[model samples]
Target: MTTGRGLRGTAAVVGIGNPRYHKRGTSEDSALALILKAILAACEDAGADPRGIDGFVSYANDLNEGLAVGAALGVREVRWSTMVWGGGGGGVAAAVNAAAAAVATGQAECVAVYRGITEADDGRQSYGKGHFPPLLTAHGIVTPAQICALRTQRMLEADGVPRSAMEALTAVSYLHAQSNPDAAAFGKPLDPEVYADSRWIAEPLRLYDCSRENDGAGALLVVPAERARDFAQPPAYVLSGVQGAGPDWSESLENDAAYTSAGFHPALVNRMWDGAGIKAGEVDVVQVYENFTGPAVASLIDVGLCPPGVAAGEFMTVDNLRAPGGGLPINTSGGNIADGFVHGIGLAVEAVRQIRGSSPNQVAGADVSLLLGGPMAPLVSATIFGSAATR
Candidate 1:
C-alpha cells in the first residue's frame, strides 16, 4: 500500500492570482479576458514560465476550457488535463486534489486549478446550462437556494440549530469584506438591521444569507513540495485532500437523506483528517465555501470543526471567525458571500494568501489552513494547506 493520506506532503501551492474583481456586467462578455489575466498573474506570482505549464484542472461548470486556455497561455505542451465532475461549488476542493494528485504521481510537474466566471449586469452567475434533470426543478425547488433551504430546514427541525448559526457565518463574511478592497461587498455594509430585514429567499434563509455573484476569475498553481522552495513565494504545502459523496449522494431534492442532512461531510472528514495527520483544533484558518449560509453552518459541524448537530450555532460566532484574536479565522478574503463567487475556487486563492502572510486580513502566524468547497450533495471536497515550516 502506498499508505497514509496518499495526497499529503507531496504537492505545494506556490502561487495564486485574481484579476480586479468586478460586479457582474461591469466585466460581462469578457470571461475569456479574465481567465487569461488570472493565468498570467498566477504565473507571475509563481515566477513560472507561461510555456512551462504541464497540467490543468477545474471544476465541472467552469467557463475556462483547459486545452483552449493552455493554448492561450502559450503552454509548451499540456501533458495532462482533468475536470472534477458535477456542478455547484462542491468541486473546488476536489479540483485542488486533482492537481495535487497529478503532481504527486509525476503525471505533470506544474499544474494549475482555476475557474473563470463572468455574468450580466444584474449580478447572477449560472452554475450550469440546462437543468441536469431528475432534479426537483418541476416543484418550486428549481435553484440551489430553494434546494439548500430544505436541507437547512431539516437541520433546524432535527439538528437543533437556530437561525442565528447561519446568520453568524453570513455576518462574518460581510465584516471581513469591509476590510478587503478587492471584494464586491466592500463598504457595502451588511449590518445587523440589514441582515435582520433582508427578506427571505427561502423560508428561514434570507437574501443576505445567499452568496453574492460577481464577474471574475481566480487561479492557483501547484507543484511538487520538494521543488516548491524554488518559487518566488512561500509555499503552502498541500497536507492532504479527498473527495467523496454520501451513500445516496446522487439523491438530491425530494426524500433524499442529503437533502435533509449535511451533504458529504461524514464521508470526507474522517478520511481527510486521518490522512493529513491533523485535526480541526490544529487548524488556525479556514475558507469554507459560501454557496449558502445554512450549508456552511452544517458543514462546520459535520467537518469536525465543532461537534455534530445543533450546538455548532454557539461555535460559529462572528467574534470567533474574525482574524487575530479569533480561535479560528474563516473566509478572511470575504468568501463567496462577500468576495466574488467564482464557483468557490476563489476561496483557494484566499487560502494561499493566508499561508503566504500577504492577506490583507492576515491571521498572525497561521501555520495550518483548511479550505472546503461544497456541502453540495453527492460531491464535496476539502484540503489542508500549511506553511513550509508548518507542523
Candidate 2:
C-alpha cells in the first residue's frame, strides 16, 4: 500500500464559490438562481466554461428548489448525476460521488456541485416537506433542532459530557464567524448565559444551540488531479473519500446507543485513511458536519481522530486552542453553527477555502483537511485533502 500523508488516486478541487452567507438581497432569490450564481462563479474560479461541465451533483432535496435546477445550470451533457439520500449530510456524499466517477470512468474531466437554500418567510417553519417521516412531523418533531437535540442530550447523559463542553464549541463557532465576513452570524459573539438561557427548542437545545436558517449558496469545481494546477488557485487534492449507512430505521442509528456495528463513522474513516495513506493523527484540520454541537464532538471521537470521550473536553474548550488558526483548527469558517446552514455545502466550501489559505478566517498553514458529513441517521461520508500535491 502507499505510505505516508499522500493521496491514493487522482482527483482535486479546483474552484470554490459562494454568495454572501446572510440575506444577499431583499428580492428573495429563488434556489435555482442562488445555485446558478454560485456555479458560474465556481466555474470562473476554476477557469472552466460553464457549458464544459461533464458531471453534476446536488442536494437530493432538489424538489425543494422546484425542480430542473441541474438542467437550468446547463449540465446538458451530464454523464454523471446523483442525489444523496441522507438528511443534512449530503456535502461529503456529493464530493465522494464526483471523485469516484472521475477516477473510475475517466470521462468527466470537470464536475460542478452546488447547494442553495432560500429560507421561508417568518410565518413558515424552515423544515418543510419531503424525506422526514410523517410520524416525526405529525408529532411535531418538525424542526431539526428537536431531533438533533435529543441526540445531544443522550450523549451528555450517557457519556457524562459536561454542558460546558457544548458551550465551548458553540462559543468558538461564534468567535470564528465574527471574523468571517461572508458568514451570516458575522460579528455575533455568543456568550455562556446566552446559550444557557436562549429559547428552548428542545430540552437541552436552546435557540443558539441550533444552526441558523439563512439564505445562501455554495459550489465547488472538481477536476482530475493531473489537471488541477491549470484550473484554480492552489487546488486542494482529494486524497480519499468513502460513504456508509448504518442499521435499520428503528435502530435510530444516528447515536452511539443505536450502534450494533463498528464506531459510527469510523468505518468510513478507516476506509478513507487506508485509501489516502494517512493516519488519523496526521490530519491537520477537520470540517465535520455539525447540525448540532454534540454530533460535532461525537464525530471526532468516532473517527479515531481524538481519544475516546475526550473530544468535548479537548477540542471544544476556549483555552484549548483548536479554533481557527489554533493548534488543530476544527471549523475555520464557522461551520453550520455560525456560517449558516446551506444544507451541508457550507462546510464543503469552507474546507476548500481552508486548504487554499484563502478563507476570510483562514487557518494558518493548513496543509491537510478532513471533511465529513452526517448523523445521517446512519448514513455518512468522509473525504480527505492535501495541499494541491497531485499535480
Candidate 3:
C-alpha cells in the first residue's frame, strides 16, 4: 500500500456547520431530525445542495447508516457510504480521511461527513456509565475518567510534571470558552480557585478535567479541490490526514506493556508531520480533542507542539495559549470539555472554521490548522487543513 500521501489536496472541506449544542433531552428535534438539520446547515455553508451529495461518512459506531441519511436528505443517489470504526471521537478524523480517499479515488463526490448523537435526549453514552467493553467489570476500570486518571498520575510521577500543569491545562479550555458564546462553558469562567476547589471525580482528575456529554450534531461538506470554488465557502484544502495507533492495537488494560500509555502523542508526531509535508511549527491553529484535560496536554506534546516533559511548563500556562499570537491557540471553539462533545466532529468543524476565518475564537493568519481526534483512547487519528493558497 502507498503512503496515502497522495490523498493530500485531492479534496477540500468546503463547508462546516455546527448548530447550537445543548445538554441532553433539551433539543427540539429527534435524533434523525437533528442530523438532517446539521446536514442542511453544512449544505448552506457550502452553498451546495444536499441532493447533489453522492456519498456519506460518519462515526460513533454507525449509530445512523448512510443510506437512511441519504434517503432522508433527498439525495439524488448515494453511490457510496463508509463508516469509520471507533465508538467515539477516536474515529472522527479518520472518517474525514476516509471521505477524502473516497472522493480522491473516484468512489464518490460531494461526500457529507458527520456525527449525530442524542446523548442528551436519551442519556450519556458508555463513558458516563461504568462500561469498558475490553476490560470486564471485575477490573473496575470502566469509565474514561478512571482510565485517563491512571495515565495522568503515571505521567506526574514518572515525568515530574507539576499538579499546576494539569490545572492550567484544564483552565485554559474554559478561558477560551468564556469568549465563545456558542460554548456550554461560555458564561462559566473557570478560575484557578474553582479548579482547585472542584470535587475530584477520579484521583489526579478533577470534575473540570472531564468533558461534557451534550446532545448535538456536526457536519462538513467535502469535494475535490478543483471544484470547491463552484460551491459556497472558501475551500480549506485537505492537505493531509491520518489515523492509527502507537504499537499495540488489541492490548488489554492489565496485560499490555504500554497500558500506561496515554494514547499515541509521542508516537504520531513524526508520521502526521511527514504525511502532511509540513512541520509542526508551521501550524497556525490547533483544535485538539479535549475529551479530558490530561489527554489534551499530552496531545500537544505527542503532536509535536511542545517537547516531551515540557508541555506543562512550556505550553500549559494560560498566558501562553489563552489568546491567539501569544502561543498556539488550541480548541479555539472550546473543545469537548467546554464546547460540548458530539464525539469529535465538533472539533473537526472548528478546525475547518479556523481555516475559513470564521471561527468564534478566530486565530490570526491561520493558514494551517491541525485537528486531532481521541488518541487517548490510544486508538486515534488526525487531519491537517490548509488555506487555499497553501500547497
Candidate 4:
C-alpha cells in the first residue's frame, strides 16, 4: 500500500475497450448493454474472467444509465462500488479513485472502471437538470455551452484571444475528426468560413466551438503492478493522478476573475507534474478535455505544458498537431471534440493507445502521455501514464 511521488506500488491499466460507435443507429442499445460489452472485451483482453472483478466505479447519476450498472457487470464479489460526483469529466477520477482504493486497501486484486453514455434523442434533456448549483440555476446559466461561452467571451476580452484562435482550434479538431472512424462528426468537418458563419450557440461561441454529443462506452481494467505482465495489452502504469475543486457558487467568489481561474485550479497541474517526477516538457502526448476550445487552450498554459498565453500560437497550429514531424502531437485519435465525447473516458482510452503505439495518428516513439479530465463543475483531474514496467 506504499504510495508516493513515484508509481512504485500503484495499480496499472492492463486493458482498454470501447464498444463500436454507431453514428446514426438508434437500435436497442442501452447503457447497461454497452457497459457489459466494454467490460467483457476489456476482461477478455486482460485475460481475466468477469467473476474475478471485486471492485467497480462509475458516475453517481450518469444520464446514460443508472447506478446499478456496477453490480450487473457480473462481478462475483464486491469490495467497493461508489460514484464520483462531478460532471462529464468525472470518468477519469472514477478510474483513479478505483485504482488508488484497490491499491491502498486489501480490497481487491482487480478493478474494473467503465463509463457508458448515449446521445439518443432524449440525451439532450439529461443536461438540463441537477448539473448546476442553485446559484447557477437561479442566474439562468442553463446549458453547458452558454456557461462556457460566458467565460470565453471574458477571456477573449481580457487575454485578447481572437476569433481566429477559436477558428483555428475548432477547424483543426474537425480535421482530426474527419480522420477518425469513431467520430460522430467525421464527414461533417467544418471549414473556417463555415465555422465563422455558423449560428451562435452563445455569444463568441459558435456551433463548432462545442464538443459533439456522442453515444459510446469505454472501459479500463486495472490490476496490481506486480501482476501487470500477465495481462493483455502492455500495461500503461498510472504514474500519478490528482483532482481539485474550486470555490462555491457565490456572487463575488465564483465570479471574481482571480478566483475564476482558481476554479479550474492550475494547482492540480503542478501536483500532477510533481507526482510524476517530470516537468511538462517531458510529456510526449497530451489528451486535453475539449468540452470547449477555450479551456482546451487554457489547460496547456495552466498546466505549464505551454508558456502562458502561447498555446494558441504554438500548439494550436494545424501543422503542429497534424504535421508529419510536428513538435507536439495532440489528440491524434481526435480529441473529445472530434473523437466523440464519451465523457473524458475516450480521452483515457486514447492516451493508452498513444502509449501503446496503437493510435491511428500515433506520435512517433510516444511512451508517455498526459491526460486532463474536465471543465467540470469547478473540478479538474490530471494524470500521467507510461509503460507498466516503468512503475
- Among all candidates shown, the one with the greatest lDDT: 1
List runs of model 2 lying over 4 Å from the truth. Answer: 1-7, 24-27, 64-76, 120-131, 134-140, 248-263, 321-325, 376-378, 389-391
Arrange candidates by TM-score, highest first: which order?
1, 3, 4, 2
Give RMSD to native, each candidate: 2.2, 3.7, 2.4, 3.0
- Residue 370 lDDT in model 1? 91
Quote the lDDT for 282 in model 1.
90
Q: In model 2, how large is the Cα lDDT of residue 132?
A: 56
What is the C-alpha lDDT profile of model 2 across 251-325, one tens digit per residue? 252344443222254456667778777788777777877767766766766777644444457656765535554
In candidate 4, which residue pairs get closer than 3 Å at backbone N, Cα or C atoms, i.e. clash? none
In candidate 4, residue 16 scores what lDDT? 81
**Root mean square deviation (Cα) for candidate 1:** 2.2
lDDT of 2: 0.67
lDDT of 3 by residue, 153-246 (tens): 8767876566666677677778788888989989998778888889999988888888887778889988887788898688888877777765
Q: How many residue-pair clashes does candidate 1 contain?
A: 1
Query: Which pairs clash in the backbone of model 2?
Result: none
lDDT of each: 0.81, 0.67, 0.77, 0.67
| lDDT string, candidate 4, 101-188, tens digits | 5754666777777777665533653433466667777887777776777767766677655555556667666777677777766787
Runs off by more than 4 Å, candidate 4: 1-9, 23-27, 63-67, 119-122, 125-128, 247-253, 256-262, 388-390
List ranges where model 1 is wrong by over 4 Å: 1-5, 120-125, 128-135, 251-253
Candidate with more favorable, higher TM-score: 1 or 2: 1
- Model 1 lDDT per residue over 183-204, tens place: 8888887879988988888977
